[model samples]
Target: MQSKKIAIIGAGVMGKKHAQTIVKHPDTELVAICDPFSDAMAQEFNVPNYKDLDDLLNTMTLDGVVIANPNRFHVSTAIQCMQHGVTCLLEKPLALNTAEALTLIEAQQSLNVPILVGHHRRHNKIIQQAKEIIDAGTLGEINTFNALWSVYKPDSYFDIEWHRVAGAGVLAINLVHDLDLMRYLNGEIESVQAMTSNKNRKLEVEDSISILVRFKNGALGTLLASDAAVSPWGWDQNTEENKTSFAVSPDQDCYFISGFEGALSVPNLEYWNYPKDQSKSWSTSLMKNKVEPNKEEDVYIRQLTHFVDVMNGIAEPISSPQDAIHNIQLLECIELAAKEQRTVYLEQLQCFKKSA
Candidate 1:
């Protein structure tokens, strides 16, 4: 397959990573870097750097574009790209809120091209393996999950002005990942109630949040995240998938899931089931086992490959525009629930009402 040309829309951490991987992936070629403050990466990659989208669009036709820009720009940029017949790989927290995300999701309906959301964890081989194990009935009617994301950020990390705003909290940055992972591994979340606080640090945004989730299949879950914690539990702390993030020693587990047949832990891939010949009871001992994922390429590279296929009509997006929008709605509902101190059901949201 010929390499499809692509451009990075943000020059920050994620955009740099995307640019590096795009240039290296067999199916993708780095066309240019597009950011207002981006001469550095452009000089480094030897590609033209445009301060705005119109200039880049006028210059050349791209097979696709990656929107790694700020939270507020996501919907507008993606809508612009899609309107101009360019597919996009939009980063997570699809829009600033459910309302904006729903508008973009609506706009996508008029287009046939793909819009793959950057829920990169879904692309992981280990996550795929876990999905298979749960589907195989080995876990036997899985019903609950205990999700955690607890890590510490230094005082200096909040120096960025937006980092102290309403949309830049742990709820937006970290919990979004855990919410998507839970939906991908478990099922659709039907309702949510949450509480969040900036108790750990005096900031405009929350430093921690705890959530209760109810799935469409009747499964329940607890999703919690805190940037003020001193210990490790999140995927960043438990795995080495991204060496840029902190990885814990001895690899602590971040998820503990249970089903009728047994229990399981994520990343570690540990499974516990009752003895085959023994009567299942509180007194019976459970057998321990482990699952190893099939070797695969890096997830981000795989996501790019998937996007290449998605753009070329070889495959559908793993996280479609609608999927991205739903995650945002989930986050919105969680925030609303936290603020109002009440449970929020998915179906009652205006987005859902529009869909129905």
Candidate 2:
């Protein structure tokens, strides 16, 4: 099959990742890089650079684009790509808020262009294996989850003024990821309650958040997100999933999922349950076994392959626009819950009014 032409829209950190990964895949050609601030990246990659998306769209015929722009611009850039009939892999947080996300949703539905949201964790082999275990009844009726992302960033990362501001806080940048993961692994969230504080940096936004969620399936979960803690208990820190990411401490358990029959710990992929044929009882000793997923696939490679498949009419998107919209809407409810100190239902999220 002929390779599809794709362009990288942002030259920042994530744009760098997209550009590097695109070259490794044989199914895609890294046609160009577009970013006014990233001339160095363009020169290093030996690709033509366009300071504007309009110029790139006009000058190059691209089958797709990967958008890693600021959260506020995600919707608009994606809408432009869709209007041009180009497929897109838009970075997460879906949009700055639910309203901005709706504009792209409307455009996508009306135009019938494929716009895949970049909730890359959904593409990870380990996460897929964990889901399959739960779905296979190995962990029967998953009832509770301990999901967390607690890591400390050095002071250098806060040098950017926007990094200390509200929309650029840990909630938008970090927590939005696991929010999608929870929705993906569990199911629809029925309600959420959250509390936050900025004791660490004392910035415009909270530095830490504790969220409680009730899944529509009757399972319950808690998500903790903090950028101030000096620890190594997150997906990125625990797995060799992506070597380009910083490796923190040696591996440790990042997730603990339990159901009626058994429990599973992530990264370790350890499975625990009472022996079969033995009566199920608290007194019965539980067995510990390592549950290994099939050898992992590079997520970027898989996602890029999937994107090419999406462009070629071979496979559907892992996270479509409709599915990813829920993540942003849920995030809205989480913010409201933290502010109001009350449980916020999914239905209430339907009309949440963001503060001006």
Candidate 3:
């Protein structure tokens, strides 16, 4: 089989990561790059670097494109790529807000182009295993989810002007990933109530947030995150998925999920339940079991491989645009809940109505 020719937009952190993964993957070829500002990566990779999206689209025949551009440009760039019938591996949030996300969702539905949103954590083998355990009723009738994402980013990390602004806070930049995973692992969120604060960082954007979510499946969840604190309790720290970007806290778990029959902790995959022979009551001691997850494969590589499958029409996108739009809507509901000092229902959001 021939390699799939791939081009990447936005030569930033994620763009570079995708380029490296693409080059290493057996099924992909790095054909070109599109970024108005930088060509350093393209030069290093020995690929043509076009400064314009149209130029890259018109000049090169690409089997797929990865949109890792700035948040503001995501929808427009994705529409352009779909216009050329190119599949996309769009980076997350899907868009800055639900309205923009809806436009991209509508475009994909109309053009029949596949878009696999880069909620790359979904590809992690641990997550795959966890999902299987839950789906198989091992954690029967899940009732609660508790997650934490706390870490202190270096002071210099916020030196960029945009980093202190409304659009680039812990909630949008960091917690969105956690919230997406919550929705992925738990179920659709029916409503959300939240509170946010920027007192610690004193920036225009929030540095800490606490959210209460009610899943459509009757499960309740709480997410607490802070980018202004020192801690080792986030998925990034616990999973070691990106060691270069985040320090690993070995053997730590970031999520605690419970149900009537059993309970599970994430990353570690520790299972606790009463013995089948014992009486199912508080008086009974719980047995601990371990679930081993495949640690050999890199999630980004798996995501790239899945993207190849999406491009080849062999597999439907694991994270489709319609599926991702809900995450964006959930984010909006969180922001609204914090701002209004009231619970925000997902079905009540205007964007959800528009999409529906």
Candidate 4:
């Protein structure tokens, strides 16, 4: 088959990364890049660049478009691409909230083109193998998942102009990944009770949040993230304020999924394949099986490849726009649950609208 041509929207960090991979991958070619910025960096990449989406859409013949624009711009960008008969691979959080994401979902399904969201962690080899083990009933009756995401935030990160938006906080940018993963691992979250605080941070949004989740299957989950943690990674911790230092260690961002019979841990993808003997509880003799953890495969490359494959009728996309809507609804629940300090059901999530 002839190589597929791809257009990348947004020339920011993610756009550049996708462009690099598109050029490097043998299956696709980087035909054009679209961005409103006039930075010289756009030309440094050496592909055709456009000032806006229409200019690129009117001129280029693209098989697919990867949107790496800001959260607020995702829906509009995706709708335009789909209307033009181009399959799209959208970056995470899908959109600012559920309502916008739902609109795009409708558009894509009606257009008869594939729309793949960039939930890259789902593409990890270890994650895939773990899903297979769970599906195979090796870890019977999943009971709970404990996902903790904590990292130091740069001061400049909070200072970004768009950080003022309601959907720009830890819930959307960080915890959404964990929420989507948990939903992917188990099932829909049935109810949520959450709390959030601004604490020493100088931002309009909460710097720390803790969510209590009850899944439809009675599995319990806690999604917690704080910008106030002193870790040096990516959270909002600063040393001068507290004069206490925190180190980025080996186990930060690690997650685990536990079942009635066994459990699986991340980075290691260690599976406690419970022994087959039913008489004796396998907890004590839990045999450990280590699968090769999915390395840092260029997830954007894999996502783009999948989009092209789905367009060509060779493969089906795993993360559809419908999945994005569900994830966004979950996010809406998290925010509402946090604000009201009360349990919110999945069906009770309110549709979010754009700010005036």
Top candidate when judged by TM-score against the true structure:
3
User: Where does model 4 exceed 4 Å of error?
Assistant: 39-41, 161-166, 231-253, 273-285, 350-356
Tell me the tens digit of each residue's lDDT in model 2 across 102-218: 777878989999988888888888888888887889988889988888888888989988898886777777777787878787788889999999998888878899999999899
Ranked candidates (TM-score, high to low): 3, 1, 2, 4
Write candidate 3's Cα lDDT for 78-131 as tens digits.
999999999999998688778888888888889999999999989999999999
- Tens digits of per-residue lDDT for model 1 on 1-356? 68899988988889989998998888789988899965898899999999989889878899999999987799899988888899999988678776787788788887665799999999988888889889898889878999988889989999999899887888877788888989998888999999988988878899988999999989999988899997768887676676665756435778889999989898888999998898889899899999864434598988888898899988989998787777878887998899999999999987777753
**TM per model?**
0.95, 0.93, 0.97, 0.87
Clashing pairs in 2: none
Residue 302 deviation, candidate 2, in Å? 1.4
Candidate 2: TM-score? 0.93
lDDT of model 3 at residue 326?
Answer: 89
Identify the leading candidate in terms of lDDT.
3
Error of 1 at 290 (Å): 0.5
lDDT of 4 at 298: 59
Residue 174 lDDT in model 2?
Answer: 78
Clashing pairs in 4: 151-235, 152-234, 152-235, 153-235, 153-236
Candidates by lDDT, descending order: 3, 1, 2, 4
lDDT preference between candidates 3 and 4, better one? 3
Clashing pairs in 3: none
